[model samples]
Target: MHDPEHGDGTSLADRPHRRRAVDNQRRSAASADQVHRAMVAVRERTPTGWHAAARQHIDGALHAFEVEPVSGCIDAVACLIPPRCGFCGWRVQVGTYRIGFAVYRDGGARVASFATAGDALGAAIRAVGKEIAGTAHR
Candidate 1:
């Protein structure tokens, strides 16, 4: 038989080399199978594998929204919006209304009356929290 690693003919003394080469081939095949199995397991466990589950959740939510499209690929919805001043800069596509502002170093005041106690408290909390946290308040 022809040998791959060694091209010359094998003698009786070369039996050990042939055995070692076969053993190495078996080990290499086993290791390759192990690596393939590991990659499959990782793909099953990672976010890339969760597309079906995420789509099920999104579909269920969208079904309740009166009418919505259901034919788009999952990757179509994965998007990033650059941060911007909603008042002056281009609006983000996530929502219809522009609801952001820019602030000067010095404090500025902006307010609107609320119709209910809950709404008033929520607005107050948001405004005060933003001021204390050094951010633009709505």
Candidate 2:
């Protein structure tokens, strides 16, 4: 007979699997929220200009990404910086390669990739400087 709650022939045997799926979704949502909050705090604290803001964003995201998760392994170092000012946005990815870095800005309209973290960071700083200059001129 069909179970009233499930409305199907499935029985208690499926309960464990369903519970696991729900738990996984909850964990994923919580993780995303944690990342978002960290990014927002970074943005709020860095309001002088895009260059300073991006620098703070990069530092904060890197710290959050380095934190160990409750389960599994972190395969990449990546973080998001929500839009702020007219000139700041970032998708910074480091440690993706054994010795490389990648970054996107202006909502991914601009992209920079590098073979070393130092080079990538320098490029990012330059990009932020340009953005700040452009905004100042406007």
Candidate 3:
């Protein structure tokens, strides 16, 4: 069969398909650059003094890389807490229908729970910065 309507002779190589923005190597480099930029921005925007601490804590355990289903994913994080308090670690309640992050300060008595660990950390950074700068009341 000639199959003129099928465009069989129209050349299969010209078939429509999504064109890549950049070549594989360039695309990979661009992606990596974007991730690094995001990480740096997040780190920088985080209050002030806490930037160093947060970077130290998250850089080691966090894999700021791309995933199949989710283009970019920040999977798993580690924080280096002071040895003064022995309560620094992943916290879990025995009988609670809640899940999120729990932050404790001043001998682990004052606890603050957040919907997500990122939020908790962000709040901590901002709180500390504000307290130090004396602009917290505002």
Leading candidate by TM-score: 2
Query: Could you tell me which 10 consecutive residues in candidate 1 have the lowest summed lDDT?
Result: 60-69
lDDT of 2 by residue, 1-138 (tens): 455545667567887776666665564554445445554444443334232222333322322222111222323333333323242333344443234345554467565434333333344445444434544576
Q: Quick one: RMSD of model 2?
A: 15.2
Task: Score candidate 1 by TM-score against the native.
Answer: 0.26
> Compared to the true structure, candidate 3 yields what TM-score?
0.24
Candidate 2 local lDDT, residue 53: 23
Write the residue-wise lDDT of candidate 3 on 1-138 in tens digits: 223444344344433311232233354454344345445444554443233222221322222221011211212122322211233332211111222233455467765444433444454444433333442243
Q: What CA RMSD would you report for each candidate? A: 22.1, 15.2, 17.1
Lowest-sum lDDT 10-residue window in model 3: 66-75
Which of the numbered candidates is closest to the native, going by highest lDDT? 2
Global Cα lDDT for candidate 1: 0.31
lDDT of 1 by residue, 1-138 (tens): 455557766676787878876765664554344334334332343332222111112421211001111332211221111121233211111111224332222354532333332232233333333433442332
Candidate 3: residue 136 lDDT (0-100):
25
Query: Model 2 misses residue 18 by how many Å?
Result: 0.5
Q: Give the runs in model 3 whose Cα sits over 4 Å from its true position.
A: 1-110, 135-138
**Quality of model 3 by C-alpha lDDT:** 0.34
